[model samples]
Target chain A: MNWLMVVLGALAGAPLRYLTDRAVQVRHTTVFPWGTFGVNVTACALLGFLTGATTAATVPPALQHLVGPGLCATLSTYSTYSFETLRLAEAGAKFFAAANALVSVLAGLGAAYLAGALATALLG
Target chain B: MTREHPEDDAPAPGPEPKPTGWAAEPADPDTAIDPWPPKPGRPSRTPAREQAAILSVIALGGALGACARYGATLIWPTDPTAFPWTTFWTNVSGCAAMGVLMVLITERFTVHPLVRPFLGTGVLGGFTTFSTATIDTQRLLDGGRLATALLYVSATLAAALAAVWAAAALTRRAVV
Candidate 1:
């Protein structure tokens, strides 16, 4: 039953990622991979929220499996983010690449913290 | 400053040196050796447009890779307080596979340009994740498994970097 939910969630998450990435590409001309960055940060926040909700007893175990494993896994990315940063640095945009990396890490953590706190307050 | 003569860049005249290996004159005088070796009845060059086509193929491949990652997690659910085995294995296996496939496709087989984007950039990029790894390690630390979490965090980072290096080296060996 939990496995079934995971499959369904992945189905939804994967296509959503693809569509969102495409949309972001159409809207922006920046060389940075904003689509991937946005998705990953959002996913991290969602994971945090879900974790908090589950811990607070507001979300069920099964739902946690679906959203956390299935949806979150499909939504977040790390390899592309790393590879692109390296490419940018190699192409002589070292400062920009380093800033991008730092921002992603720090901002992602902040988003997760906010999401977790929000979920805890609202759900509890 | 006045510019130097173009002929000055050329090598000075010397006694004719004996050729080391193949005696055939290169097709391009600017290059000392043939970059592309002739194969029996095989074409010497690929079309330029093929490189551009790889991006779309990779994006589609990424979707599949992400889905596969979710599937692997489902099969091995980790306890909240314990080490995350599912993510660890997923990353390690993905890294190893990337290494092997890079060699086989880039060197041993005549892989289409589209295939590299699909498999290397899209699929592998999507399959293995570092964000989740970081989050999981932090969670483990927060949950009081400090030693396990530290080990997990360092191992993933070091191993993944090594894996990429190994893959690139293997591909170079097979090609050259």
Candidate 2:
């Protein structure tokens, strides 16, 4: 059951990331990767909510498996983030490269912290 | 393939000439998530059909990669208070693999258009997660382990970047 949930969630999450990336990328002209940044932060917030809910015992473990490991993990990607940073630096956009790495880490962590706090307050 | 004058025939025949760097490469979008920009002179397919095919491959690859990640965690569950070794290694290794794969597809080999979407964007993207890493750090901080959280976050970032850079450099030098 857990395995099936994970597969199903990934089937959804991966396609969603691709679509979101395309939609976001087309709208932006800046060299900064808002598409990947948007998806990663969004996933962090969602996983944060799920984690908090699980800790509060308000959500079932199966649901957590489906959403957390299955959905959020697939939706947010470290490899692409790092690769994009590498590409930026290689392209001589050193400032944007550094900003991309620093901002992404900070924003992702911030979103997770904020959403976790929100879920804990509401559910716990 | 012998050229009468390699300098004159600068446009070597392949998917694209080996990019010396991003400078030599065309000014395509730097983000690898975008589909390979349509090469000139190739027959165009129906846009909807191409998109559906790409999405299907991405879904399939994502499921496989996610399962492998889940299996790794199940096999090596971390203690609640301990660092997330499984996820850390997963991200680093996946980044390393991404480095090598990108060099190959872009420089060394001429792959089918869907290969990059499937392997790079789908499999490696699904395999290494940013959300889990950030949330795990958040959990550590919430538990009053600020030192551990800081170490975890910085170490993962540094190691992931270093791994990708080193992997790509080595792959370029050794393989290409």
Q: What is the TM-score of chain A alone in each candidate?
A: 0.90, 0.96
| Top TM-score model | 2
Runs in model 2 deviating more than 4 A are: B1-46
Across A55-91, the per-residue lDDT of candidate 2 in tens digits comes to: 8766866787889889999999999899888888887
Pairs with backbone N, CA or C atoms under 3 Å apart (clashes), candidate 1? none
Lowest lDDT block of 10, candidate 2 chain B: B26-35
Interface RMSD of every candidate? Answer: 9.8, 4.8
CAPRI quality level assigned to candidate 1 from its DockQ score: incorrect
Q: Write down the lDDT that model 2 would get.
A: 0.82
Model 1 regions lying over 4 Å from their true place? A26-30, B1-85, B95-126, B145-155
TM-score of chain A of 1: 0.90
* DockQ each: 0.15, 0.50
Best by lDDT, which number? 2
**TM-score (2 decimals) of chain A in model 2:** 0.96
